[model samples]
Target chain A: MVDYFNEDITSLHDKLVRKEISVRQLVEATYDYIDKTEGKVNAFITLNKEAALKQADALDEKGVDPDNLLSGIPLGIKDNIVTKGLKTTAASHILDNFMPVYNATVMDKLDALDTITVGKTNMDEFAMGGSTETSYFGKTHNPWNLDKVPGGSSGGSAAAVAAGEVIAALGTDTGGSIRQPAAFNGIFGIKPTYGRVSRWGLMAFGSSLDQIGVMSRTIKDSALVLNAISGHDEHDGTSAAADVPDFTAALNQDIKGLKIAVPKEYMDEGVDDDVVSAIKAAIATFEKLGATVEEVTLPYTKYAVPAYYIIASSEASSNLQRYDGIRYGFRAKDVNSLKSVYVRSRSEGFGDEVKRRIMLGSFSLSAGYYDAYFKKAAQVRTLVKRDFDQLFEKYDLVLGPTAPTSAFGLGEKITDPVTMYLNDILTIPANLAGIPAASVPAGFSKDGLPIGVQLMAKALDEATIFKAADAFERHTDFHNQVPAFKGGQN
Target chain B: MISKEQVTHVADLARLEFDEAQLNNFTTQLDKIVDFVDQLNEVDTTGIEPTTHVTSAVNVFRDDVPQKGEGRAALLKNVPEERDGLIRVPAIIDKEED
Candidate 1:
């Protein structure tokens, strides 16, 4: 029997092609793996077992084909992306029973190439909080340590991949949702430029910042996924029309003469000492690899956290208005008036974080406050982007820590919203600047929690990130360290 | 700092219901957050144009044609209350449905 759960996508694809394993057997083995590890991980909100088995059986009958890019590989999808006939909750009670009638364009892109999606994984409620602890379904634990949070709102997606629950997963990033979780879980996740991937099927958190990207075990594996899903779709007005590249081709590229920058602003006092040392070590590694590393200043780095919250919350307040109890999902009881129905259903259906964001957004967008808060924040966003534009003119990429520290305890910062929001400080600049960024497992903290080193390149320059991250992985074995699962009948 | 009455007005605008305890809880928490984010006021943003989106994509229009996607039956299937394939809601004028 194949150790299906432990294998990466490339080798898994090779084995299927050589008749070393049948697709049905592979799918069954994955199910066994999930049963053994899921209790400890709590990654999925809904497992697609019945349908996956049926599909795998049909795929086995057709015989394995390697020409198909994904070719029967197993994947996990974040809950916010819709799949026809399957429940997509965004890890909130309001959408607890919401079933989609159509698959996301990304799902359709993967489906055409025959990738088997195993389940919809859990995440922070409506993709708001930095920790998965805010999810209505309950928290997703960091696979490395049960007490710590898996960074969110793509926490489950990163956690599942780290624990070998799925080969890879799709996650949406708005202000570092995908990268932070991937860092916290010691995996590789890429948040392509804002318009690089279609957002048509994604649940909107911050419309201008949100983009669907890959969360995977390795940069190469994620590159293959990016190859299948990146392009313009008429459905999403903002999707970029740039030609999709063969991202996998970038894996072996030489970074010998690549000019890179290390942001001085992010290395400020807010960064944890252990994380700073790890990222410094990473920069030294890049320098040793023949890449030139120098200091660059993004003078407005401190402003990203506040600006992102205001901009994202303002958009979220507008986006979440569709969840009134009249159609789809959960509704309130004992409401006599239409106005009461709107208020009661929403207040009861949403979690604390969701409510806070909506209120925050409402306050920002209110008549008297718009010009001072929302408009000022948007102008700050322009300055942030201009920072990137000026630096990218001289350097090929910029590097920093994905977060200030490694994954913290589950309830550590949730009590104070500002403290929780501070976790996104280093990662939000890329979102504000509309650039592509990625997090690769750099090292571990003193407590053994994983730390991630971030790499940001200009828009549509995903190849540079892959090239650099692939180089780092080749020289280190940190990504190979799997969390020892503990709990529930295994 | 935002007062309790102002907090209530924002919640009303957001269409979210809250009891007295919740209002108090939120007021305390939100005041700290707002005060924290008010640091943005210190930056010089004069003559800087607001960036609505970071991309150059604009004015994209798709062909108006029939497409096969999710149908009405599946959509209406999730309604909390329904009648004759229409989603039912409480009366807008404060009248309860029996």
Candidate 2:
């Protein structure tokens, strides 16, 4: 059996090329490990084992390509990415049985490189919640401490990777979904610049804020996947036409004389002391490596959360209008009128958190309240972007804690929506500004939950983010530590 | 502070319905959220131009060439109800009211 805990994409690819392992064997081993571990983690919404094995057999017959690092590597996809014939529910009852007629652009790219898709990971319904508890499929427990959340809406993807069910997973981040969960799971995740990856087939929550990204045990593994998925697409017009670089080439690059900025607002009283200390130590490590670090004021940071919610929800309220029960997805039974079908289906299909966002979004965009809420929030968004733009003038990257605190207990903040929303304060600015940001395992908290330090660079500067993150990974042992939780059935 | 009436009105606009208890609960929660977001009003955005898209790219266009679309069978596969290769929906105009 292939041991995912010790193996990464590059290592597995080498093994396949050398004929030391067959793709079929690797696919079998992945399913075996997932079957053994999934009872406790509850990370997946659907497992594509039968098709994955078939793909593996075909790959084994075609033979492994030596140059392709991702060839035969198994990955867990976030459930929101459309996969033809595979159930792609964004952990919402609305699309519980959704089978896309075609694959997402990212899936098509991965398929071309011969990557095996193990299954679709669970997420918040429509990627709305900070904790995965809002999912219709139930919450995903953190592998580190079973009672704690894995973080959302990419919680399941993070947990699955941390549990060694898959070496790497694809996750989407609107407001900290990918990075926060990666921090909680003690792994690596990177959300590329807003237009770095295509969103043509991703279930839209916030069109302006959402971006697809990668999560893995190592920074290099994520870079390998990012290299394949980063580029322009005719399908998504927002996708940048900028040149895609070989991201893996940035690994182990020197950090001497690199200027780093720490926003004073990020290190304020809102952050937990443990998380702050971990990030402080990380900053010190960069200084030790000959990089200069300074505390800079990004005063507009305080307004980021409010602006992010307003903008994200407004976009979501518009994007989700497509699910009207006439074409596809869950339809309310016994509804006679078309209006009744639309109302009843949406009300019955969506969870509370989704309804809450929709209400807030609709209210904000209403005729009477537009200027006070939506327009004001959009204007605040300009200031937030300016904060990053100003910082990028003096600093090559902005470093801070990915989340204010480590993963909290599953039900601790679910009942309080505002408290949950505030947890994303640090990560939201990156999305608002449309910059590339990443979370790498910095250290563990006093209670043994993982903590991650976020490194953000200017728009389309994912290479620098990767370079700095890889250097940190090389110097730290935090990424090597695996969770100790065994499934109850085990 | 947001009232239950406002929440209900917004829910209707969003094509969602809520029971009395959920409306009461959501009103309280939404009030807290609105109050929290109200802090954004403190910032001075008077001369600022609102950013609609983060990237400067606009009016992205491609060739007008026709491409093969998903066939009717594939498109209708996910439909809850279908007839004559088209999605079936509840009647839009109420005959009794007319």
TM-scores for all candidates: the values are 0.97, 0.98
Best by lDDT: 2
Q: What lDDT does the true structure give each of the candidates?
A: 0.90, 0.92
TM match of model 1 to true structure: 0.97
Q: In candidate 1, what are the lDDT values of residues A1-490, reduced to their tens digit?
A: 6563457788888888887888888888888988977778799999999999989988988877768748888899999999988899999999899988788899999888889989999899998989988888888888888778899999999999998878899998999999999999999999998888888788888999998999998888999999999999878888999998899888877789999989898788989999999998998899899999999899999998899999999999999999998888789999888888888899999999999999999999999999999999999999999999999999999999999999888789999999999999999999999899999999999878899999999999999899999999998888888775432231
- Candidate 2: tens digits of C-alpha lDDT, residues B1-98: 78888888898889998889988999999899899999988998998989878988879899999999999888899999888888888787987532
lDDT of 2 by residue, A63-170 (tens): 999988888899999999999899998999989888899999999999999999999999999999877899999879899988899999899999999999999999
Give the DockQ (2 decimals) of all models. Answer: 0.73, 0.84
Docking class of 2: high
**Model 1 misplaced regions, further than 4 Å:** A4-6, A486-490, B66-69, B95-98
